[model samples]
Target: MARHVLLAGIIGSTAYGLAGPGSDVDRIGVFAVDTVELHGLRAPRESYVTTRPDVTLHEAAKWCRLALGANPTATELAWLPPDLYETRTALGDDLVALRRAFLCAPRVRAAYLGYAARQLRTVERRLTGPGGANPRVAKAARHLARLVAQGRQLYRTGTVEIRLADPEPVRRFGERVAGGDLAAAYRLLAEAGDDLDRGRSPLPDRPDDEAVERWLRAVRAAHLAVA
Candidate 1:
């Protein structure tokens, strides 16, 4: 059976407005199949892919689960600019409408900061390893800085800014990290974490799970009826 592609949009560096001349265009999407297919002898795959520019499409249920957990990659897909979309059906519009339903201050803090911390550790390891300085460390540092900045904005505004609206400061911090200034990188991460720990965020502690569930059920029902 043909997969129903509910949403498809640009992601990665291009989606973030950080793409350079050599940057590859990356895309992600969500697709849904009839519920019966999921309950049959062979379960539908959780993901699909296409090559060239590179697109990774997750099953709708799987995407919803990841978004609920504030998986940065998956959640960000819902916030992409309208012009960036290559495909968006009514179901996709509904999915995007519920983007805020997946956001909670605490989850954003954990997801963004935790991912940045992992990047920092990777950079630290690379710095101490025989490879010395490499482009990967600099890239990781840039992403780490971006994550902290994005996390802060989300906590304060309840919305994520995928592209760095102001990239200068992050650019400078990335330079420090690239120069082997691990101290500065750690400081940035700590400061971001501390700010979030203050618990001053105006966002709710948990997402609107009921609303999301209702939407999911409606979508599944519509798909099943047509199938």
Candidate 2:
């Protein structure tokens, strides 16, 4: 499974330029199974997640489906900076080139904002639920900020910036929220909604399904040829 990885890259805080001391090095990858494997009654696993090394690998077809829906975490793999990549084949390069073909206005808007909403719930839980002042409250807050900002940028420009322009501000914002400034977090979330509502995105209303299909077929063909 590891050997079949087509594309994999560093992601999360490290790739976002927000890592500090003790931050985990997270990675995401795309892999392919032999085409013949799909002909059987049982299908091969489509995803693998590990906590020790903090890595996740998704099969090629599954990855394409998630990317087409504008899933922020899944979509980041194709947009990661060159230096962040640990594996890159010709097939991987093709996937990266088709990254934009996966974006669409409604999905981008819905998926990102929806993800941000979930992060907001986590922030509320960590802040008000169990232990007082959990450090994860800050982490959740930071991600909440990142998702909104990144989502807004993606909606407006049709591309995601993996590295933050100024991570320090976001870090500070997180600290402030962690220190019981919930109002600020709410404000940021509200701003995210407003930004989404105000834009006429350059992205089409839907992803380029034909392009994605062609690319997925190419991946399967490549795997079959190699096998």
TM values, all candidates: 0.93, 0.97
Question: What CA root-mean-square deviation does each model show from the true structure?
Answer: 1.8, 1.1
The whole-model lDDT of each prediction reads 0.83, 0.91
- What TM-score does prediction 1 earn? 0.93
lDDT of 2 by residue, 1-227 (tens): 45589999999999999998989999999999988888889988999999979999999999999999999999999999999999999999999999999999999999988998898888888898878577898998999999998999999988889999999888998899899998898889888888789868999998999999999999888778435
Q: Write the per-residue lDDT of candidate 1 for residues 3-117, one digit (tens) a residue.
A: 7888988888787766668777998998888877767888878887777858889988899898888888898889888888999999889989888988888888889899989
Of candidate 2, the 10-residue stretch with the lowest lDDT total is 218-227
For model 2, state the Cα shift of residue 173 in Å.
Answer: 0.9
- Model 2, CA-based lDDT: 0.91
TM-score of 2: 0.97
Q: Judging by lDDT against the true structure, name the best candidate.
A: 2
